[model samples]
Target: MKILITGGAGFVGSALAIALKQNYPHYQVLALDNLKRRGSELNLSRLKAAGVEFTHGDIRSKEDFDALPAVDAVIEASAEPSVLAGLDGTPDYLINTNLFGTVNCLNYALKHKANFIFLSTSRVYPIKTIETLNFVEEATRFALSDEQPVPGVSAKGIAENFPLDGARSLYGTTKLASELLIQEYNEFYGLRTVINRCGVLTGPWQMGKVDQGVMVLWIAKHYFQQQLGYFGYGGTGKQIRDMLHVADLYRLIDWQLHHLDQVNGEILNVGGGLESSASLQELTQVCQEVTGHTIPIKAVAETRTADIRLYVTDNTKVTNLTGWKPEIGIRRIVEDITAWLAENEKDLAPILK
Candidate 1:
């Protein structure tokens, strides 16, 4: 089988490409990336070393896909990814890349008759709705109340049936819009497609930043003895999110490829679930334990408009169908990232620190 991965040089994209190639040497894998993210260019060598072909191209341009050959599948992983994007008065890049670029990818898939797999964001759920969830404050984190006033949410976390009304952020808006488009393509064009509404996905090689990939960002800050801050929810550092290792995601995608008929037209929520969730304070403690650094963290009472206090995926839907669940816990995720950072300190310090 031949595969094309957009954002192929990115953390998730590159990791998926390398894993697929390593596990199935007979499968031809091509990774196309614009390398817009800071540390993405670093993955070119890793991709090549793993026997995955790399192409420097932007999905925003239709002409870029003209040079590529037909593939059996197209993994749409390219996006701006930052929730804070366009708040500084620049929506062009986020919208064009996340929405328009997806359309271009869809066209490419249509032309090739390839199965489409979209990596959508959990941000597609309304922020206001999630904020309304009831929770109790624990010493290190916030725990969801057993009962929720909202549908499709509970202590188990947010489910696939969560209501999708209200503002979720410009970054999320584009992804949700793209999801609608993908559904249309699947219905109208008869393209086989599956959408995974993923929560925080992190692992080694992710160039994490404050706006996204906060798990790795948290570890990186502590690893280098850098100061950190909690900006929302009265600055108590109680905001929480579930994390999924990229390897776990790769396993699911691999299974989906083999069982596309079963998962076709399915929109499932994917994440590490409640078992792998952590609050900022909890993550800080873990980071301190792993990195052996005790850095002071500043707390600000003001909440970012685009920020949500908690988002855990209830993976019952996907788990039942695919029999897949994230095996890596928060500490394990941190350990892996720490190891990667330590191994490549000389090369990563400038970017991560």
Candidate 2:
């Protein structure tokens, strides 16, 4: 069976492709990417080395999908993964890629009778709702107490059934909108599909930026001894987030692909869950532990308008369905990134800077 991974050269996509090739060498895995993301080009070499075929194509263009061979499965992993995406300017690129891009991918999926797997974002939960959740700020992070059960959250974190009503930011809206579209295709057209509303995914080869990829960015900043900043929410650096290593994501995807029949047409919250959750303050401690370097950090009371103080995936639904759980914790994530950077420092330092 051949699998097509959109955003194939991306951190998640590439990692999935490599794992597929290694575990199931007999099966063909092709990676289709626009290579538009700045650091995605670097993965071209890695993809080649993994024996995963690479094609340069954008999901925004229908022609790209039409030109590709029909595959049994398509993992729509492409996105403009930043909450502050459109806040800085027009959300054209984010809209075009995350929204229209999914349409194009779904169209391709329907045409081929292929299974569609969408890597949606945890940000799809409304910002107003998330920010309003009851919180207990500790020395390092904000957490939900057991007393008040948040509408969309629990001690397990944000679940799939959580309220999605308010403004979830433009980047989130696009993914949520795409999830709706994927559902339509599944119900109306009988296309087999699974939607994973994922939280912050990290690991090696992730080109983490300021607005997105906070985990990797934090690790890199500390390892390189670069300056970092904490913004908003009193700038205590206590805002929290759960993280999933991209490798753990790949394992879950593999399970979903093999069990498409049992899990079709379901939306699941997938992430590191409570065990892998961390606040920026806690992350700072982990980075220092991993890199043995104190990162220079500045703080400000003014925060990004679209930023959420905390988010963690409940992952209960997916776990019940597939027995999939994030195997790596925050320390392991930092350690992995730390090792990756140390090995590829000569080549990665410039882009990271």
Candidate 3:
């Protein structure tokens, strides 16, 4: 089987490419990326060493896909993933990449008759709805109350059926719009597709920042002894998020590829679930324990317009269908990142710090 992963040089895309090639030596895995992310170029060497072919290309241009050979599947992983992407009043790049880029990838898949898998975001759920969910503030974190005002949400987390009426962020609107387009493609073009509405995905190789990849950003700050902050919810650091190790995501994608007929046209919520969730305050404790560094974290009571108080994936539907659950816990995830940073300290210090 042959696979094309858009944004293949990125942390998630590159990791998936390497894992697929390593597990299926005979399979051809090609990674096409523009290397727009700060640390993405670093993965080119890794991809080459893993016997994965790398192509320099942008998803925004249809001509870029023309240069690549036909494949059995396309994993649409490229995106301007920041939630605060267009708040600066410039949204052209984000819209073109996340929406139009996805259309280009879909066209490529359509031409090749390839299976499509979209990496959608939990942010597609409206922030207004999520922020209003009932929660209890514990000493360290905010816990979702069992009784929510909305359906498809519970103490376990938000599920796929959560209402999508309100406005998500600009970043999320693009993804949600892409999801709709993919569905249309599947219905009209007979395309086999699977959509994974993923929550915070973190592991090694992620170039995390404050706007996204917060799990890794938190660890990076502690590992590098950088000052951190609790920005919202009265600055108590109680906002909660569940994060999945990227490896776990790879496992699900692998299963979906093998069973596309079963999962096609299915939109599943994927994440670490409640068991793997942590609040920023809890994350700080873990980071301190892992890095053995104690740093003062500033408190800012003001919340970002795009920020949500809590988001945990309700993975029940996916787990029930595929029997797949995240094996790596929050602590293990932190430990793995710490180890990655330590081993690559010389190379990563400038980038991560």
TM-scores of the candidates in the order shown: 0.99, 0.98, 0.99
| Clash count of each predicted structure | 0, 0, 0
lDDT of each: 0.94, 0.90, 0.94
Residue pairs clashing in model 2 are none
Residue 57 alpha-carbon offset, candidate 2, angstroms:
0.6
Off by over 4 Å in 3: none
1-353 per-residue lDDT for model 3 (tens digits): 99999999998999999999999999999999999999999999999999999999999999999899999999999999999999899999999999999999999999999999999999999989988999987888898999999999999999999999999999999999999999999999999999999999999999999888888889999999989999988999999999999999999999998999988899999999999999999999999999999988999999978899999999999999999999999999999999999998888888889
The TM-score of predicted model 2 comes to 0.98
| Best of the candidates, lDDT | 3
Greater-lDDT candidate between 1 and 3: 3
What digit string (tens of lDDT, one per residue) describes model 2 on residues 81-111?
A: 8888888779999999999999999999899
Residue pairs with backbone atoms closer than 3 Å in model 1 (clashes): none
Kindly list the per-residue Cα lDDT of model 1 for residues 1-353, writing each as its tens digit.
Answer: 99999999999999999999999999999999999999998999999999999989999999999999999999999999999999889899999999999999999999999999999999999889988999988888888887988789888999988889899999999999999999999998999999999999999999989999898899999998999999989999999999999999999999998899999999999999999999998999899998899999999999987899888999999999999999999999999999999999988999989
Candidate 2 residue spans exceeding 4 A from truth? none
